[model samples]
Target: MLDLQNIRSQFPILNQQVNGKPLVYLDNAATSQKPISVLNVWEKYYKEINANVHRGIHTLSQLATAEMELSRQKIQKFINAKHDYEVIFTKGTTEGINLIAYALGNSNWVKKDDEIIISYLEHHSNIVPWQMLCERTGAKLRVIPMDENGILQIDILDEWLSEKTKIVSVNQVSNALGVINPIEEIIKKVRKNSDAYILIDGAQSVVHFEIDVQKMDCDFFVFSGHKIYAPMGTGIFYGKSEILEKLQPFHGGGEMISVCTFDKTTYAGLPFKFEAGTPNVGGNIAMGAAVDFMNSIGISNIQKHEDELLAYGQKKLLEIEGLKIYAEKAKRTGVISFNLEGIGIASDVGMILDKLGIAVRTGHHCTQPIMDYFKIAGTVRASFAVYNTFDEIDVLVEGVKKAQRMLG
Candidate 1:
């Protein structure tokens, strides 16, 4: 069990009030509130060791480089990558996915008529890059369909998987519906049926549980640091060393180069090859701090607490007169998406909730396909974090009922 008080106190933002009421922050799916430790690290990096990394022989540069590399090591261990070199830093999950798509498209890995698979539940980040890749490479994009319950129909992969499939990218959890996809089964099916490389978008899953990349055995895994209590503009892209070695670099610049001449250029090895130019040194170090913060409390405890919150919040919200929860029967973590019947739309309900100092995401959540699948405009998404409480869940429930009464 977690000491909710101790955990909550670490986030100073939770103490503030909004709209004349205590803030009930449930918009965690969009981005998480930075903990004090992560915030302090950001300040500390700039105050004590602010310099461009891997570029200078000065003490501050070395310190910044060391600290940033230490963060890389921490993330490598955090995700259980086989080699630290396999962990490449990026702007966020979107960049990581784009890196993969761009690199693969440049190489012979994906070619004309090659197929790439994604799911109907993917965020635009996961969807667009592949679409662009298909456009660039003449590859055909394939989608795995979902059932009425919002669960992925993994069985259909039997028909979709083929020799021409080159990449299979999917989210470990649906950002829109909070549905946990059967990635293991999907990976197994891909391995059995096709030679495609599998990439799991761990942007949501990383916050909810421990990720062992070696165990998961996906060819590539990507996530954003902001989703896991780190600052924005920091993210991780983990690819198997062999696969990364074979693919071309996403960007050509200083840090990712081995030798540069007017006539010829050679790229650097492993992670550095993918990570080009200057990076968010402070943010990446703070990402390491965020990892330390989660480790101190233990990921399992955080998962358990959020799971409880999900169950409690769902039960309480369902008791309302005319509320409909999407993916109600699916296994979920840290998020709940729903619509209050008779309300004008998710945005109206979200505005009402905001007036009560309760924050929730309104609209497609960058997932228009999900809305189109359900035949709805959008949903009210109340996503939780480790610091969130049952009382906040109660507050959210009451806020929803108030929205219904006012709007309906």
Candidate 2:
């Protein structure tokens, strides 16, 4: 029995109007709106407990360190990771993937001629790392193709999984087309086909669905905090204990070193080994608050509400003449990437939407590879969050209709 009206009131930014019209934030795929709870925690930390963590004996230091660890525990519970140390904080998904790629590539596990498989629907963050790793090592990169509907070709993936494939990284959900990948089933199948390690890009999935790394049994899972209603410059990279122990450290600096001598140096353990330099203390702590906020409201509630919004948006948008929505899969998220007929440029349409106080993302969304596969320039994307409502969709529907007439 979650109260949607009460929840909407927690976001202060939603109260204002933009461009002389009611603000309609539909670009949630880029980043979500922050609630008061998240902002309050950040403000409290800066005002009260602003101190470096895990170093000093001062009371402020202790308080900051405790808060930081509490955040880790919260994240551990959020994704159901067995150990808190498995969650390593980084900048965002881009950094998370790069860390994995470099760490695994430098190890003996991923060697020359070893194949790393990624899907065609992958963002540039996922694709380029493997490409760089392949270039550095003599490892080969394999791509699993997608159908016209933007669904991954399971038959093709089955054929691609072989003994030489050492790593398989795929998005838990496609950001470009709103396609919810069958990651659990795909991971299970990958295990049977080969002993390859799997990493799931959970950027879009974490915000929209319930996630359990233990149940998913993925070797690594990565996501950004910004997309989950937390501050920017914070992300999580969760590696299985056994797998984490095998990979080399990705970065080296202050907190990550255990001992440094003239002869040799030793590294720290688990998460500290990955977190280098001064971590984003405020952003990391705020991420915990974000999880707390989502959990308090219930992830199931968020999913159900978002699904309802998506359905309402789709039905409403269909009423518009010559509008096309991508993907009709049973499993999907709240993202809608579309194009209106006779619209010369997606960018212009996006500008018009902005003029109407409707925020939407345009362009390839950093998945230019997918755009190249489909032979389309880009799409105008409108993704929803839990706070979104049917009324917002009506505003967007009217906005699109107006754009259609104006562009024509």
Backbone clashes per model, in order? Answer: 0, 0
Number of clashes found in candidate 2: 0
> Which residue ranges in model 2 land beyond 4 Å of their true spot?
none
**TM-scores for candidates 1 onward, in order:** 0.99, 0.98
Q: Per-residue error at 194 for model 1, in Å?
A: 1.4
Residue pairs with clashing backbones, model 2: none
On lDDT, the leading prediction is 1
**Candidate 1 to native Cα RMSD, angstroms:** 0.7
**Model 2 C-alpha lDDT per residue in residues 190-276, reported as the tens digit of each score:** 999999999999999999989999999999999999999999999999999889987889988789889978798898998898998
lDDT, model 1, position 120: 91
For each of the candidates, the C-alpha root-mean-square deviation to the true structure, in angstroms, is: 0.7, 1.1
Question: How accurate locally, in lDDT, is each candidate?
Answer: 0.94, 0.90
